[model samples]
Target chain A: MTPLPRWADVVLLPLLNVVLAFLVGGLIVLAVGQNPLQAVGIMLYGAFGYGSGFGYTLYYTTDFIFAGLAVSLAYHAGLFNIGPEGQAYVGGLGVILLGLALNGAHWAIVFPLMIICGGAFGALWAFVPGYLQAKRGSHVVITTILFNFIATSMMGFLISRVLKPVGVNSDESAPLEAITRVPQLRTFIELFKNSPVNLTFFLAIIALFFIYWLIWRTKFGYAVRALGQNPVAANYAGISNQKMIMIVMAMSGVLAAMVAVNNVGGVQGRLILNFVNGAGFVGIAVAFMGRGHPVGVGLSALLFGILYQGGQELAFQMPGITREMIVTIQALVILFTGAMGDMLRAPLARLLARSSSPTGAK
Target chain B: MESYLVDITLILDSTVRLAVPLILACLAGLYSERAGIVDIGLEGKLLAGAFAAASMSAVTGSAWLGLLAGIGAALMFSGIHGLASINFKGNQTISGVALNFLAAGLTTFLGQSWFKRGGYTPQLSGDQRFNPITLPFAEQLREVPILGQIYFELISGHNIITYFAFIAVPVTAWVLFRTRFGLRLRAVGENPKAIDTAGISVTRLRYQALIITAVLVGIGGAYLSIAQSAGFNNNMSAGRGYIALAALIFAKWRPGPALLVCLMFGFLDAVQFRIQGQVFPIIGEVPVQAIQALPYILTVILLAGFIGRAVAPKASGIPYTKER
Candidate 1:
């Protein structure tokens, strides 16, 4: 089959997939006797209508951007890092420990240390699976899946037994002082009033550009892409596939660790049980929908951010529709964009070819 | 000594009970993976079956009807998986992941909307659940020596599905190794191209394998809600499906070994429950989470070839395409 035009491949195909996902999501709403159009309207208004709502959307978007970039970086290395959830969870330990240790320190001092420590922890968590895959011939997918479960069990123990403050009923660490916590954007900007959007949002934006540069403009990026496309050829070209896999996975873990920085440092101000809350899983859909491109990841992350904030509002407004409807939609997006991605390709290419043949026949 | 014997018996009995769902789902994976389909969505199918069975049993007040509905729900999920992987030639892993999320989201969404109980079906009772059946002379045998107590306490009182789970192992072994269709199915998984060249329909054999997978996994799901817990709760399969998948890998995709691995995992679970908050002779206090995590940790070790190599079917996770 003929390849699709660059524009079609990059933009049109993803847009069609998103549209198909929404159409099916709409059918789900309709199945439950809710008006799909009304649900969409509520979602749009909830996501962007007010200042605080838009702020929440951006807050959620920050998490997705990091998670998406994490998954995308691994995708470029032909690795599926499904343990981002676990990595992020373990990263919370670093963030919390640093925050607690520097409880009276200034936010400016505490924030960067949290990032470094948390990134290190997350990277270490992911590095194990990568190292195993590299040296031991274990498939990263299965090992990563197992790591997620281990993280859950390990984190559950720590939060409940090891870290919980004395006399505290909840399974959480001692909260950081307000001065030491990542300052919310609302403190400086009136538009984001009462929202949790913080400096991490800006960090997320910078990371997106940095990842783009790292993945596309660097020689290491070429090696990674070459490895992904054909490992044997990349090996013949002197790229150590094992070293590349390990480094790329560690980098992906660092990206995933940003979720912890966003949640524990920026919003929660303490380590809590299950705080990642499926954001890492959302990265899988985001990376697939974005086709593993930073620019596309940004757009899809924003789209999911809207769906999340709007879905919350819709659930409150429509008794029939619930928050899980967004999850269903997210699953559909993964299905159409990632799995059955090429189902429409042949027909679309045929149509484009037929339309352009008259002028191109010469 | 008598008290120790009783404790061992009790633990063994719960081990059998806990192993039932894992055994069934592992057998399910055996069939599907043997046909070269990597089904990570087994957890979702189990949850879907649990929800459907609980909802139907609550509404119809018949455990049999609930079982059928549960199987139907799992089959529907398998059909979606088949469509994506077999027909559209999509990424089998991604398709499985999507189906899993779909099952999770749809089950809870519908449960909340339909039952109005925060993603839970109504509590089942009497005919609405598969209650344990006592074997003949179980009461009479309980008063006898160790052998009689073992028969009565350890073997006599489980729901029918538990019995079926044990029975299905030998049946699966026979069906996989002794039948013509079984040979064809294994051939398709090993080398679909060879089967296709020999005039056999690889797709048909795979779909048949998936159908069997759906039935076994559905039964397992139904057993969770109706026999074990008496109703469906959100995410109630609680990673048993994934555990079963791990067991399948641990067994090297063989039916008999799959049963043993599941029982071993189940024993770990029972031991975890028994030892929680308890002190031991050498270990002092054992962390409950450590025991909970043992199965997964072992699976990773096995997969990493630290224990032994686990070689999957050659054609697994690759979609087939006919040569042009």
Candidate 2:
């Protein structure tokens, strides 16, 4: 098979896949007796036409960026960290516990401590599965999935029975003090009015750059890439595959923990049941769609954020279309970009080879 | 003593009911995995089947038609999985995950659009559902002795799907060990290259295996909406597909042991429901979530080889290429 050019592999292929996914999504909208073009218009308008909508889009994008980075880091280490959902859930415990402990502390002090505490907890949660896969030969995919269920059960018990304040009917912790919570961007920027976009959004941007550097520009990154490509070769080169797996998984968990910071610390101001709300799962699609590149992840995360914010508006305005339509589109994106990613490769390679051969002959 | 016996019987009865879907889905996974295709989308298939079955039954008012629709929906999902993994040589796990999300989203999206009842089908009854069937002499034997109560309560009244699930174990064992098709399926899973060398098409065998898997899981899904309950609710499969996957691993891909593991998990579920909010001696109230999480926890332990190693088929999760 002819290899694709780097540009085609990195950018063109992903764009094609996204286009295919949306085309199919449009067909689904048509099947449901709605005008596909109209639906697209509504989605685009909802996502970017107004200031607050764009703010919400960015807020959602922040969560996806962290989650996507988490998956991408582990992917670079040849690990599928499917337990981001679980890790993020457990990470909330850390954020909430610290927030409650320093009830009225300044936001500047509480925010950093919350990140450290939450990242540590999430890393610990992910580290166990990594250790199992590394030492005990358990497959990380299955263990991580089971861990998601366990985390759900454990968190449900804790939130409802242990953490819920007396006389409170809902399963949530006490609200953090206003001064202690991460300040929303709207406080400083007039354009992001009434939006939950916050300091964590900036953290997400920094994390993306940090991941790009850590995955490409460092010795550890070389080892991770080597391990991912071929474990036996990496082992022969004196890189401990076991150690790499555990560390990469922990790093992935730390990235995933940022979702908790975005939601619990930035937006909700309290730990609530199911606060993650499928954002971690959304990360899977984003990571795959991005092809594990920071730039790609950023763009795909923003795309999903648009779909999410827009889909809500679409559901409200268009009675026929529902919010789940976005999930279907996400599924299609994963299908095209991740699972059956190479379905078009043969034809694409042939076409490129045919077209380039004539040009290169000169 | 009598009340305790009655309580035990009731729990066992519910256990049988609950285990039926797990049993079917586990067997479905058994067929697919035995043919070297990892199906993580079993949960999605179950949910799709449930929605299809409920919707079809509501429309046609025929339980049998609902079963067919359920099977058809699962088969469609299996086809997508096959197209991606078998034909396209894509990542099997990713394909499965995609199918699951697709089923979840499409089911609800379509359900709410068509039914307008918040992702639920209309409540089914009468001929639209597979109601419980009382075995011969069950009512007559109710008045007899302790044996009569056991027969009447525990062994007599279940829908056809439950009976089929129990019967499927032996049938699967026979088909796997006694038939040439089964031998080819197992060979395809263990070493597709060898089967390919033996003048048998590995792809055909795998597709066949997947077809059987779809049929079984579809029946399980139908049983959920049409037999066990009245209609399909949102996410009604409720992770039974995953629980079945766990049972499949726990059983180490054997049908007989798969049944036992599913039953054990079902027993845990029944006990969980029974003991919820109930105070017990010494331990006080056992949190329902603990028991709910027990199967997953145990499977993790088993997978980690704390009890024993649960080895999968050699060729599972790898896309087979001619050169490879």
Candidate 3:
């Protein structure tokens, strides 16, 4: 296949999206009278260059990976899966309960079991919308949005009412015992003279590889992709469209659960309100930004994690810029990359189609 | 028995107040989606309008002027949404979600930075408040047994906006069915290609409809801020926008049904508020969370085939494209 033309194969689309986002982001900075170059530099350094900052970035990215994966799985089955936020919380509850309720079992056995429980619970939550979409033809967007509020409020109810921290008046769960805990890597960064990245970072990469194999190297993958492209055609091709959608949604649920299990169990180790903090929504941005590719999703998640960490740091250092600026930047990035990018995608797709047609046919 | 009667009256009055904003916002949503645009940003637009109205009213000492400012700002925001989604033919849902996120961040930032408040704008006094109109025979009516409280409380004594919200229902019905512009608007929504062939501009009609919805939603937001609480706070609109969308779906996008749907949801919310201390006295302190979650849970149930399956406008949430 005489090496696919570089521009048509790669360079243009993702590059164009990044450039467009930056330019729009730059205009926003200018509007606020901040030097675009310096702000960008500061954001980068604040996220990665500092000792503590990069640690938080890695920690944050771990959650993002789950979110990105969740969105991508749903996207593969032609479902938006907007309920990741809800699924993540349910997963968070599952892991937290497991951690608290279980005694001092062996680490290997207990940890894996909790993770599976978290994923299964999360997946079950996601399946409701998927089932509705496939069977009743309900719009996934409205259904999922509805579930998010229910999940958040229900979790809050349990945490504050039934699962309140022992010997405390406040609305919080008791922190997990050390035997059931994820060992802190923050100290290991100094002790081992290594980066602040945790064991979860390695686990995330492994998960991504597994996702890639599941998506590309499996028969299920073919069914999902086919369903996404055209469910009617996929049905004609002897694939069960409804089954494929349910499976994909289940996969998304597990991915969303990983965020909750890993974040709550491996990092925070307690149930908290708003703790998911729009990561699910950001995952939608990442899924579209990455064009539903694993590697692309990983990179976008890292970039977002960096920005998030930096945004927190900037709030502390500047005193002038508020913590909400981070959210503004996030919104603007999503706007340019998601909606505005579509405005440009059609033209680029046309150009690629034209250039690659006859030559590519050969 | 008298106490029970007072409780019923209070609950009735609360339902009307609760339903007015939902009715208005749902009507706004009906117009936009009917014209082939999805509006997930109603919550955000309402937030921006609420904040603007509250701040403007507090500063200028004129509630009416604040309402005008709120409408103007919302129209401009909706115009941005239309330009991005309709003209540029971008993804409508993404644009709407982005607008919400932007509003969430921007308003909070400004509220804390400028106002030096706890993400809340200052409260306004009676001078900037709207008065409700009570029934004329209320003195004689409350003593008139069965229909007494209903006539005095539920049927009457609602603010001007509540009356307007109910009237707007028929006006929307008439505009949608009788008027030439409304027919063309529906045509653009249902089948833009047909409208394009019939010498109508799809882009223009959509933008016009969105802007009109924006104005109505702006009034709804003003009612939320000044009329609901007589002030504003960051994120005060909460999830009212989503609830309205739920009502719109539950209503199946028609005004007559939309009004009833809003009232039903409003009733649910009002009952939840009233019962937190009675039925769930043990969970009495949980009112804030319970009430907050009520609308969303109802929405999910409705979507899951409780009330009915709601089919949206056929061409909704799709960006219209034309050949160059």
Clash pairs of candidate 3? none
Off by over 4 Å in 2: none
Worst 10 residues of 2 chain B by lDDT: B315-324
Provide the lowest-lDDT 10-residue window in model 3 chain B: B279-288
All DockQ scores: 0.81, 0.86, 0.56
The top-ranked prediction according to lDDT is 2
| Residue-wise C-alpha lDDT for candidate 3, range A126-245, written one tens digit per residue | 888888777777777778888888888888888877778678887777777666766557655663223335566667788889889988999988888899899899999999887777
Q: List TM-scores for all candidates, in order.
A: 0.98, 0.99, 0.90
**Predicted candidate 1 versus true structure: per-residue lDDT over B59-178, tens digit per residue:** 999999999999999999999899889998998888888888888889989998899898999999999999989999999989998999998999999999999999999999999999
For candidate 2, write residues A229-275 as lDDT tens digits.
Answer: 99999999999999999999998999998899889988998999989
How would you order the candidates by TM-score, starting with the best?
2, 1, 3
Q: Would you list the clashing residue pairs of candidate 2? A: none
lDDT of 2 at A309: 95
Residue range B1-324, candidate 2, lDDT tens digits = 989999999999999999999999999999999999999999999999999999999999999999999999999999999999999999998898888889888999899889989889999999999988999999999988689999999899899999999999999999999999999989999999999999998888899999999999999999999999999998899889999999999999999999999999999999998998899999999999999999999999999999998999999988888874
* CA lDDT, candidate 2, residue B18: 93
Chain A superposition TM-score per model: 0.99, 0.98, 0.90
- TM-score between candidate 1 and the true structure: 0.98
lDDT of 1 by residue, A304-349 (tens): 9999999889978998888998889989999999888888888889
lDDT for A254 (candidate 2): 92
Better of 1 and 3 by lDDT: 1
Model 2 has an lDDT value of 0.93
